[model samples]
Target: MPVEIKLFMCRTDNFGALLHDRDSGETAIIDAPEEAPIIDAITHSGWTPSMLLITHHHGDHVEANLALKRRYKLRIIGPEAERDKIPGIDDTVEEGSVIPFGEERIEVISTPGHTAGHVCYHLPKAKAAFTADTLFAMGCGRLFERPAPVMFESLKKLAALPADTAIYCGHEYTLSNARFALTVDPDNAALQARAAKVEALRAEGKPTLPTTIGEELATNPFLRWADPAIRKHLGMEKASDVEVFAEIRRRKDNF
Candidate 1:
């Protein structure tokens, strides 16, 4: 059976992804913020969720897990380390574990930092990664519960993926993120061009998301702190990659 990956922007700018297998008729939801949107998506798509994949224990991400489980009677799975935080977790997976989602499999990558148990689900066959609050379109998530160094390492793990991997992140923070990215890498032609494109898309009331890893590697200043040009722009003397990343993130937090 072939698998279908459907991207749903649910719950007031939060992303809720659904993966469905045509032959088996099994569907899985990657993160649940609320039941209304999730139920709407399932009904609208004519698919029933067999499983719910939680990236972390953040309420904005997992608040609806129990509600949805009661409604759909679905299995809830998430990072093993955060098992105590999430309710009704049937399976706790770690990095490198592969879980069946319909006909395809999602490789669990433990990318802590956003919340210490944050993970990105990578479907190699689909070339898509559900990066909840770790890597955004043109920006990275704020280092709220963790330090900058840890988030940097988590981002590094994702940056190693294939260039074409589709990044389905958590929020609709792209245009704002692009604006900040340009502040750090103003001379980057790619960054400038992408900002313009994002502007047009936003003006048209469209989403500027699901950015490719290749595009991020080239234009995202958060991911490009190691580039000599960015380091020079930051006016740092012999700065390590993490140092540059820290400066960029600090500036972004203020931006």
Candidate 2:
């Protein structure tokens, strides 16, 4: 059976997602942003969490780890590089590691830029990727622990996934990302349309998430570093793709 996913708001702008396997009765929370809301979401959905998946050690992402572990006795899985920082991690995984959850296998993709140990979870069978702060709807996370080129490489790895793959990221930053995207790729019709749609969604208090790789490929400026228009807009028409990406990231830092 296919996996069932639930997305809810937790903390300030953080999104909490739950993936459930009906046949095995196994449920996992993608990131524990806060205790109360996550617990409430599980109770409201009538699913018992058997596992907690940590994408990184950022406080907003892992603050509820210990509470959830104590409440459900859940097995905590996180990046091997940050195992020491993530609370209650039962097992550490890195890129190429395959984790079993019911009939599905979660493939870890190390995406280290926002944080040196950040990782994204991909479930091929479910056609979903939990991209914790790496890739967003119309933007990528700010380069914090690593340089722009490193982050660009990581984004490339995600862009290479099947176009239809659903992206479940960690925050509700799409509106802001969309605004910033327009400044760099003003000529993108698809991006302009998406920005309008995102604006309408936010106006109605809705989420602009679960964006697909195809949509990002079409509209996300961060993923379009190779495009001629974006390069020209930034006045780097002759620059390498990585250099273009670095410039975009640099501009976005202040955007």
Candidate 3:
């Protein structure tokens, strides 16, 4: 049976996602932003939590770890580099590590930017990636702990995934991200259409998430730093991709 994914909002705009492998009845919570909502989602979905996967050491991401671990006896897995910071981590994984979730294996990809030890989980079989704060719908995470170049390299790693891969990010920041994207790539027809669609979805109080890599490739300005239109818009047509990305990020910072 295919994996079933359920997403719920927690603590402001944070998104908590649960993935269940139906064949084996194994369920994993992507990030524990808060205990109440995550538990509620699991109860509503009728799936027992078996594991907790941490993407980074951010408080918003791992604040509920201890509570969830105490309640479910679930093993907490997180980046080895941030082991000391993540509260209940029973297992540590780094880039290239393969973690078993029933019959499916989750590949750990190091994507440091927002946090120095940030990572993303990718399930190749499911063509789904849980990118907590690394890659967003039309924007990337703010570079808090690392430089723009490092974040750019990390995004490049994620962009290399299959274009059809479903990107599950940590926050509901797509509306704001879409607005910022339009400022940089106004000539992009794809982006204009996506922004309108996102606006409709938000107007209906729906989530504009689980964006596919292909959709992001076509519309996300962060991933389109090399696009001639974006470079030309910033008058950096001759600048390096990293340089263009840095400028875009700077603009988004102030936007």
lDDT of the candidates, in the order given: 0.88, 0.94, 0.95
Cα RMSD to the true fold for all candidates: 1.3, 0.7, 0.7
List the candidate 1 regions with Cα displacement exceeding 4 Å: none
lDDT of 3 by residue, 72-147 (tens): 9999999998999999899999999999988899999999999999999999999999998999999999999999
Residue-level lDDT tens digits of model 2 in 1-255 = 469999999988999999999888889999899999999999998999999999999999999999999999999999999999998999999999999999999999999999998999999999999998999999999888999888999999999999999999999999999999999999999999999999999999999889999999999989999999999989999999999999998898898
Instruction: Please estimate how well model 2 matches the true structure, expressed as its whole-model Cα lDDT.
Output: 0.94
lDDT of 1 at 201: 95
Deviation (Å) of 86 in candidate 2: 0.7
Return the lDDT, model 2, position 58.
96
Ranking of models by lDDT: 3, 2, 1
| Residue pairs in clash, model 3 | none
Sliding window of 10 residues with minimal summed lDDT for model 3: 1-10
TM-score for every candidate vs. truth? 0.96, 0.99, 0.99
